[model samples]
Target: MPERASARRSSRSFAAFDWLSVLVAVLQPDGSVQYANAALEQMLGVSRRTLVGSDFSQYFTDPSLIQSAVAGTHSHDFAAVRFEAVLRRLHQDGIPVHVNLGVGELREHLVVELWPLEQQVRQDREERLLEQSQAHKELIRNLAHEIKNPLGGIRGAAQLLELELQSPELAEYTDVIVHEADRLQTLVDRLLAPHRHPHEVGDVNIHEVCERVRSLVLVEHPLGLKVLRDYDTSIPEFRGDRAQLIQAVLNIVQNAAQALAPRMAQGDACITLRTRVARQVTFGRQRYKLALELHVIDNGPGVPDAILDRIFYPLVSGREGGSGLGLTLAQTFVQQHHGLVECESVPGRTDFRILLPLP
Candidate 1:
């Protein structure tokens, strides 16, 4: 009866593993697969029944890596081991993945978890971006405060000087000072805009936001640019600030439009507004079952490599006469809605992806 109970418990646990997003497998001490979860089966493109008796190393291009990982776990060198390798699927090309091999307390079998290397790198990048964004916000706030006080005094002094001026030529000097001060004040106000307003939350349809941005982009670049929409209309509305979301998307699309000027002259400029639902996404160190993915993709000369990593930072513009606040504001607005904006650019393709968690 005890043996039957143990078997039943094992079956129940294995059944529950099917629902996990991460691929998992149970391996015997000799490296034979004892059990493979649904995610693992799907990843390997082979059923669990066929995988149970096979060597786990057979699924990887470098079998020795898996063998070493399993050996280390069995020898008690470590409770868990992790490494990067390429996974081979039946009749398919090898896929790069990160593997975590571990031995549970029972020590009956080794547990392995696999994550796509691209996804792992993306997750790490997002975490770093989040940290950098936080730091940037703090710095902007402090700088704005420091500049705000002296700015008023300077503007007031410029006005007083203008009033006391006798010659029109002298008046021009004070006029320059006042005008420059006012310009700086306007810039400071823009820098504070994201923090100044309270988010007005409502049910936001992402397609509507995209459409609004599309219309604006077309109006600005009425001649040569083609703004295309590839939306997954089935996505449900989530709660967010509609106006802010529209502005966020508009900034990215507008930037893309600006970048496409060269291609536009050649009659080949294209910007695609693509939207889809992403499942099992991780953002800001938390995992979500569903998230909205919005992409502003453009075919143009890509962002310069020097400023690519710092593109989201304020005052880091790749274009001449750009205020450099567009991407920063977009990122701030998205983060307000518990989302993130990421960019990947090559010579002819630049993709700006915004990920917002869904309800």
Candidate 2:
């Protein structure tokens, strides 16, 4: 009974690593695989059963490099080691990876993580995106307030001028002024919307929010766009503002729907709402143990490179006749929940991912 219970506890401990974004393994002192995470399983194109009890060093191009690294830890001074190497993948060419090996709580096992070479670049980009978004929110809020007072004053002056027009035909000039002022007023209101709302926090089921947006978008474009659900229901609920999340996800989904307008004509448009739980994700200079990953992916021509970087900025819209506040509002809402949104696009696929901390 004691042995079985200990085995169960170890199994539970390693299960958490299965959802991490990077490949992870618990290696025996000799570099045999004690456990292989889901990410590693997928990367190596092998099942956990095949990976466990195998010599982990053999998977790398230079087996002696890893064997010596494992052997060097016996000196007792080393806590961690990092190196760049090529990892051999099943049925694929060798992949360039940054390998990080660290001492685990149990000295008998070492915790090793394999990060794709691209991960560092992606992480740097994410950090920059977070910083830029912060700067944008502050600048936009101040700018919007500065524009608001003058806007109201201009509209009032125009209305008063229209009432005193000596030649009534000249009222057309005042009318144009008032019309443009109203449009600008609406824009300013949206810019301030995220700041104005009080967060009503509660336990949030992300799938519920995705379903709400899916139904709404489907209603708007019922016959043409297919809104598919790819959800991991095992994810636990977290504390958040349900309404704000709904709005955040809705805006992203709506943006994708509009982008898919061209594909809709041929009845092949698709927008996928994919949800998964990510473990040990780091962004905004903080590391989170677990996070909920929600992706709003569309089959479209992709975001224009000209405006792709500025999509989160207020008043930048990729679509013609768009108010451009949808994505800005979405970014603000997600950031309020201590999360970040990222985008990756190619000619046929545009994926917008929202990452929020999970309990």
Local distance difference test values of all predictions, in order: 0.86, 0.85
For all predicted structures, in order, the TM-scores are 0.86, 0.77
TM-score of model 1 relative to the true fold? 0.86
Summed backbone clashes in each candidate are: 0, 0
Cα lDDT tens digits, model 2, 222-271, are 88799989999999999999999999999999999999998999999999
Q: Tens digit of lDDT per residue, candidate 1, span 1-359?
A: 99767755765666666666567787778988877877677667788778977998988878998898888888888777776777777844554445543344235778887876666677788889999999999999899989998989998998998888889999998889889989989889989999999989999999988988899889988888999989999999999999999999999999999999998898889999999998655687776778999999999999999999999999999999999999999999999998999999999999999999998
How many clashing residue pairs are found in candidate 2? 0
User: Which regions in candidate 1 have their CA more than 4 angstroms from the true location?
Assistant: 1-23, 28-55, 64-84, 91-107, 115-117
